[model samples]
Target: MGKNTWIALFAVVSTLGACAQNDIRPTVRISPPIAPESTAMAEATVTMPPSGYLDYCMRNPAECPSSARDATHPEPMTPLRWAELDRVNTMVNASVRYVTDASLYSRQEYWTYPNGRGDCEDYVLAKRKMLLDRGWRAETLLIGVALDLEGLRHAVLIAATDKGDFVLDNQLEQVVAWQETGYTWEKRQTAANPNIWVALTGDAAAPEPFEAPATQPILVANAHGAESKPEVGTAAPAHTIRQDAEHAESTPALFASTTDAILTIPTPKPRPLLTARPVSADTFSLSYTTETPVIDTAERGGAINGAS
Candidate 1:
């Protein structure tokens, strides 16, 4: 071959090598993901804990175990875990009676697990304790406070899971996603530390403490001229009992309080478990009913349940 022809061929080979290294294909940028990168709620500035929380912590030290660091991550959701959540939520809701602190303890706010009769705060306390006892992580099971649809302050147990945050509420029987609860979430205990809470709202200040409505002593009416006394273990009248979706008359037994002398008490009946049909080992349909009440009471304040 001619020398000039050989030089031209070498130049062509050099150009091909440069083109290969440059990767002349058109640059295509992938569109950013539309779905959120994380389902976990966005936490805001750290704020003061709710009223009566400190006192309650004083009474029960085990619940507020860590204040310094993040102890555990959000729980990974599973069919068995979902069933446990539903069981505890439904059980506590049905087993506890809603009464104001003034009516029961004669105080504005009191936080304790409901035994037979108590108010909203008591109900929440019961659910949290039960879940913790079931070996659930303390950091994942957070106490959330929000303004209800009625602008009443309400409390719900927020279970932070890999899927999302779920609310275990006393007012509603179904376990629902936090965003669907119709509550303006104000604050919740931080996942890093159980004792330290962070505001969901942008502000860092703590919300105003809740004050219970003043309740008058309930008096019983009698048709006859003779005084009437309630039997030791009888249920309240049908009219006063709140009917369920089935319109069935199911309520707790009414009992007279020695201090307040209130005779018209409606006790809670044990509610049935949510239908837990497993879709797979890791996933499950937690939806129980379509007729579930959507409104969660924001009454009183944090630590208070939906009923009172």
Candidate 2:
């Protein structure tokens, strides 16, 4: 081969070798995706109160009670005197008339001491005010929301006493323990800081059992092919059916035989051939005939052949 030809062949081979090396290079790999950690732990650590109450607090900053703001001051955790608690609860409940914020202030939500009439939250605020006036620490008294027996949202004043947490409700005449109200505890203001609130854990009380709905009993056919009417009101127990069966056994044998005869009578078999045949395009006739017997006036008292 000529010198230029050999040089051209060598360059082509070098290019091919370089291309092969590039094609044989190792590929870059990517790691598989990983699932994110759960947020339940975060939710457990940080909690908040109801959105409605928080929004009200933010909008009516001026209406925030002075006691709530000064809740941070150290106070003795002394057991609340029962007589004092009862007095304060009853006095505040009677002093305020129940009215809604919309009806009283022409606003959606407002928290303040009621002059004469106010809503549930208003009653709570008024009770807190009275208790504070009576030298009770602000932290001991809190405003909370709970689901009433009807599952409706309700607000009440919770007084933290050494005996237990007692609720002062405007709907009730007297104070009651928090657990006895059958209310679902949602959230409450912190004892350490009235301005802050925390989520309540654990089930409250189960709702009361409701009476079973009334139902109409289905009509059933007896052995004699007659429908039996059931008595109205609550259903009879299983034992009642046994008693009825026993009572039926004491019935007359003739009636029992009649019932058995009615039940045991086999249904008449269908005719082997149809007795009806078409006679004309517009009408048809039955092959069998039913004859009526003639009666004379003198023989009217005589017995008929098919009479039972």
- Window of ten residues with lowest summed lDDT in model 2: 12-21
**Residue clash pairs of candidate 1:** 70-192, 120-305, 121-303, 121-305, 152-298, 152-299, 153-298, 252-267
TM-score (C-alpha) between model 2 and the true structure: 0.44
Residue 256 C-alpha lDDT in model 2: 22
lDDT of 1 by residue, 121-190 (tens): 5667677777877888777778877776656677778887777777777666667777666677778777
**What CA root-mean-square deviation does each model show from the true structure?**
29.7, 40.6
The pairs that clash in candidate 2 are 99-118, 99-119
List runs of model 1 lying over 4 Å from the truth: 1-38, 67-72, 202-308
Against the reference, the lDDT scores of all candidates come to 0.47, 0.40
Instruction: Identify the candidate with maximal TM-score.
Output: 1
lDDT by residue (1-308, candidate 2, tens digit) is: 11111111100000000000001112232211321111110001113443334323322322222122332332332434455556666676667666666566554444445667667776676677667777887766877776776666677887765334667777665566776667776667665444345555534422211121132111111222121222233233321011122212122221121111111111121111101122222222222111111111111111111100
